[model samples]
Target: MKNFKTLLFITLMGSLCLTAQNNDTKRADKEFARFEYVDAAESYLKLVENGKGSDYVYGRLAESYYNIFNTVEAERWYAKALETSNDPEMIYKYSEMLKANGKYKESNEQMEKFASMRPSDNRATAYRKNPDYLPKILEQGKKFNVQNAGFNSEQSDFGGTLHDGKLYITSGRNDSRKTYGWNEEPFLDIYTLTENSDGGYDNPTLVNSYINTRFHEGLVSFAPDGNTMFFSRESYFEKDFEQDSLSRTRYGQLYLFKATKLKDDWDEVESLSINSENYSVKNPSVSSDGSTLYFASNMPGGYGQYDIYKATINDDGTIGEPQNLGQKVNTEGQEMFPFISSNNTLYFSSNGHLGLGGMDVFYTKEIDGKMAPIRNVGIPISSNADDFAFIIDEVSGEGFVSSNRDGGMGSDDIYTIKKLQPLCDVLIAATVLDDKTREPISGANVSLYDDQGNKVVTKSTNADGIAEFIIECEKDTELEVTMDDYESRKVALQGTSDEESPVQISLSPIEKIITPEEIVLNPIFFEYDKSNITAQAAFELDKLVQVMNKYPELVIKATSHTDYIGSDSYNQRLSQRRAKSTEQYVISKGIDESRISSEGKGESEPKIDCGTNCTDEERQMNRRSEFLIVSGGPESQE
Candidate 1:
């Protein structure tokens, strides 16, 4: 009887041990299904350390590491899994992981082997074509380490809002009342989490049901005083309503909810009536002063399927008419999830413009009631997946966004992003000037040329008689300065350092004969019938040609004026012909064709003022030919 009793006890102990191992395996599987790879990995490692699992254990551990982006460990376990089992899933996942880590050659070999095993697999075919199937942007550091908010798995913890050392996220994980069908994966309810001294978040607790409900809710924005809150909520068919008005009005409707701080807790939850039935609004962004509200909606008369609109808040707490931000801000695609920073710069996500693949975050500044050009935040902040819904901590400069790209836990994951301050370098300045009078000449063109004579930047000076410019040049750069009558100047500088290092240039003035002492002639009346140059005019022009021939560097602006006698258009054409004739005569005498510019200011700039009707002397003054000393030697500069 003693021997039989000892045997029975040993049999029961063996059964209990087997049951415990099975239960452990089941727990790991459950964690994996919930996309909790870190926890699942811990469980799998425990099983491996205990040495009580099948080949599947090695493969599962490898997959968990790959999901968490531990490439070295993933490779080690994948090799171990291969030694135990030649499963196709394990092989494919291993090849993908190798490719993701830039081991393309080895990945190709594994892919070829997998293809041979499963010739009908289209995924294998894709891998064979492009073994390094990872996006270039992802390789440029788009992926980040994600921290799971330790809330109930059944809750939807998203649309996180940070204000005054607290984080408010939406989660439906605890809503026991099933009054509505889940629109999002598991639905959502609003919850708040406070920050601890160590910069970690405390466990999230549910806000009052006045804000959260059995229905879907998310996207909270707070006023500066923290007294008012704006959020989005949707009512579904399962909710009890007398007239089903919520179905028509509140379905996918974003409502504004407000609460007052009572002692240490927020109380007095009330719905704000600032919406209409014509459009569904989401993503509310209040201006820094809290006077204007910017949100995304799909209303009529918009540039795209969905656009961003702005409204003014009245003193009585009512919203003004929503104004479409015009085509400059709105695009022909979906634009949502707006965030207005303290600087009044608007940041939002859009799917309408060129991007990696999915929605990308873009920013534009509001300058004097006009929006500046929108600019992409570029790589690392954007990816080849839906990257949206971001918030920045004002003091820490740390932020987070959502992405579902290649290297995440599942379909979507929250990622933390920290701004990296750019490196600072030295400042440089370059200026161009006329060598003679030292007066800053307006419209003087300057070009910075390279060693190969290729132009870099063409710029003109400002009105301060100084054409000041800043450039970041490590070595010497050649510069070329030229104007209409001035000789082109070229200079080169070497070993110039410091921000305020002066690069003052002096261009020698080109010599010319169009000074005040040159030949002069006024208008010569033709007695109502004339088409030839008069004797006095010919003599004056002869002197002008002599002046032109003397100075090849001079450029004369010859203008012809006409009286308001003939048809205005006809007189204008005639004056233009006369001016061209003078220019042609100068060119015929061997003067450079490029040195002269002619124009007809017909019946304009009369020496004496007159009404519609004018005296003969006034008409004579209007019908004269004039030459201004536009640019030349000493007196022209004066």
Candidate 2:
């Protein structure tokens, strides 16, 4: 009996030790899943340090180290895993890591080994299509220490809005009622979190029963007062309730719900008048003043699949007509999730234009009643993932964006972004001059180049004959100035400083004349039976102003001629008047009148033989004015 008891004690101790070891491994796996890669790697390293380095443990350790960006440690464990096991998944991942680390020779060998082991697997063939596919952006994002907000776990939490020291995030977590039809995703509702004294967030609580329905709701925006809320909701009641429902409406629609603070609590949720049955609207954005509402919709007469529309808030708190923003603001592809910054600068997401793929954030400004060209906020804030639903604190440059890239809890995760100061201060200013006089030349192209010889910024000279580009210059920089028909001048500044000092550049005008081989002008109109200039003649004269503006050094002569339908003296007087009218109109349009000379050729310069009996059209064609390049101006021969 004593001998049997000693054996049982030994077996029981061994079983307890094995169970503890398995529990540790599972804890490490959970840590990795939570994106605590360094902690997971430390746990796996302990197992490796002990005499328990199995192939599975080694491979998992390598992945954890890779996530932590410890390439050296990752490579070491990957080699151990390859030596210990013939797992196809392990081999494939190891090969990819090797390729990413530029160990192509060994990477190719491992890939061949994986391919040979699984001949029927076509993943290797598909991967070869984009062999250089490195998720560089995602790899960098993993370094950011993002913490899960500890909201509902089983639902997707995204599209957070910070207002009045509280955070509101949308989630699809299940509700207690459970009466709502399940969407393809979990049921979504808005939950609010207040800020703690230590700059951390408190436990999230449901905002109100009025706003938290058991249906899909997300992408909420609040007015400046925080009393009015706009959110997206999808209703499938027509299809989900009916017995033979065939409704195909699966898209989200925008809804405005009013929440008034009454007795220290928000009460009475009601929809706004902007909600329409004709179109689906989502992603509402109100201007800082709260007078205009901008939202994304797929209504007719839009530029693309989805475009941003604006509706004015009437004095009586009603919405005006929905106006399409036109092609200038909208594109041929979907543009959504617009957010108006404090300065009224419009920021939105677009998938139509050139980008890193998925939706990229673009910003535009409404200046002088027209939307300026949309500018992409490049790099860092944007990536190849769907980086959208971003909101920035007006006072601070701190903002948050939602992305589904790797290193997140699951699905989409919210990331905090803080803008750093300008990298380099390159004071790029240009002084334009008259080439012949060596004076200032206005409206010339001044561009800045980086070390890679790519143009970074461009600006044209202002009316003061000075063009300035406040370039954020780094070490090695180049500046280039170009003008029409002129030799482009480039200056390389080595070791440029990031100081506030300015660098002035000079641009010489072009010496050569680039006249078109054939010149055609729209026929000038005249009063009936009269050859005098009219307001209609000002249209052709404006074209001459444009030509003079582009080619400042070219001189031209305006010759006016009349057909044989009138007397010689009358034709000469009319021709001279016409010539003076053209020259005077050019001067009025801001062109230097000295660059043009007028001549009256009367009936001598007719292109066709038009007698007194000719048709009105033929006579009108002969009674015309023409422009010819006479000579080079002061700067033309520079």
Candidate 3:
């Protein structure tokens, strides 16, 4: 009887423990589904401690950490989840977490695995196309100067937008407000920073209590007239949510709201028609002319978890149907926080595009009524951590960017950004080669000159024949190369730095075809039956002029001949005109006219001597010119 009682008690306690774990798992899942990541993570950890760790629990834990931007915890849980989870998105998120933690090699391994699993995914396709994009991203020139804003608090603060001189941002620094389960920070509220006389911001204050609620509120956009504003807030403010019938869990989403400025405060708050209880619509951005409203939403048929959508603002104060920004702007990764500048450039944040890591900011501008391919806004504005909510003033060239990168005072800090320069620094790389052998030429001097003929810098070609220079882009520049026993060559830099291959420049040897009696030159071409100096004729004549200038006492006699098509008398006159034209060209190049003489041989000096049976090749060879050095060489004769 005592053994039986002990067994029954053990079984009852075991059943009760299992029941408790089941209840805890359900509670944690409810929190996670409601976006309460902080509480969900804690609950899931407790379940793991109680020996209830499954693949589902591990994935939920990993995702909870990821949503909170806790890279360390996220990476740990993702590794555990991947032991049994085959989901490609999980693998991608794992890779992102690894990158955030600076495990780039490990991150790449996970990315390759993810790409194999989901080859058609946009992110996967992008990876397969360029597996080694990190170097290019890191080598990109800096575009903005970033500095920590003084008003940042110890908690998360981001989503900065500037209007009229006042800076507005979403922050979680209210110690008096209720803390959110997403991060242990207080519920987010809209705060304003007034610009001071020194072009700096003053202390932050709540924008308006009526516009803010106990739930999250921020990410504001102002109309051009400053009389109205659109912002985001949790749907709970309007008592709109979906309740799970069994668990009574209320799931709320961020919704868009608009308010009108009344007297000193804002009022007349109302939700936009686009907000729905089934999906989120947040991060409102108004166009400069108030003709369009851009926002991020996870509504039905989106390319990613949240895609940026823009709707026309009807003149009657109603919004039109939202339209997707298309695949060029919306990838199969999260794209959010769309900010349209006065110049119609759309700036947003995304992880789908290739970048340094995490969510990098990107921008696109309309070209000929079509949106251009998006380009990453590159570092100092982006980093290994989550960087989003970028806004810029096109006129002032100053703006604010939000980042959770290292060295910030909080989880996500808003940094003031100033446009230092356009992304106009170009790396000009050239390879010098021998013209005769087509082999790399080492120890060659390569110099760069600006459009103003100012010498920028000089570098020597290495063993592989490479000389690199970084110069200001979009400006005309020249590259001049020289080497011993090689003719100096100068070429204008043609295309922009987008070309990856080094510019190959072949240099000819300085040894021309010269003999003791004459300076041999290539055939100088002329028009049919004409004596005008063609471009080819001038080029060959320059060689003769160069030889004459080298030895001041050198004299040259130019002789010209004609093919047998013309009569001898007519051929004589044509040949004489051609000879005189060559002589005049040398004189135009500053050669002494008296040193160079001319003579016409007509058809009498035909080297081929084919006569009427002459082939075209024989006739071409018959029409030629000669430059004889009458005086000035070791074997010269007077």
The RMSD of every model to the true structure, in order and in angstroms, is 32.2, 30.4, 28.3
**Backbone clashes in model 2, listed as residue pairs:** 172-187, 254-281, 424-473, 426-473, 432-440, 432-441, 433-439, 433-440, 433-441
Give Cα-based local distance difference scores for all models.
0.64, 0.66, 0.82
The segments of candidate 3 whose C-alpha lies over 4 angstroms from its true place after superposition are: 1-131, 424-638
Which is the winner by TM-score between candidate 1 and candidate 3?
A: 3
- Badly placed stretches (over 4 Å) of model 2 are 1-152, 175-183, 235-254, 422-638
| Residues 9-39 of candidate 1: C-alpha lDDT, one tens digit per residue | 9889868765866676888877665444556
Best by TM-score: 3
Better of 2 and 3 by TM-score: 3
Supply the global lDDT for candidate 3. 0.82
| Model 3: worst 10 consecutive residues (lDDT sum) | 493-502
Q: Name the regions of candidate 1 deviating beyond 4 angstroms.
A: 1-155, 175-184, 235-252, 267-274, 314-316, 406-411, 422-638
All candidates' TM-scores?
Answer: 0.47, 0.47, 0.50
lDDT of 2 by residue, 256-319 (tens): 4455656655676656676655566778777888888888888888999999988886766567
lDDT of 3 by residue, 1-638 (tens): 99999999988987876676567689998876655556688889998998888777898889877654566898999999899668888999899778756677798899999999899999899878767767656656477899998788899999777766778889999999988777789999999888898878878889777888899997999988898899999999899988999999879999999999888678999889998989999999999999999999999998988899999989877889999898888889999999999978799999998887899998876643456556777888879888999999888888899999999999999999998776444557789999989999999999877764545567799899998765545667888887766656678875464413258899886555468877778787887876756544654565666566666788889999888988999999888877876765676567776898888889989979998999999999999998887877634423
Residue 366 C-alpha lDDT in model 1: 60
389 in model 3: Cα distance from truth in Å?
Answer: 0.7
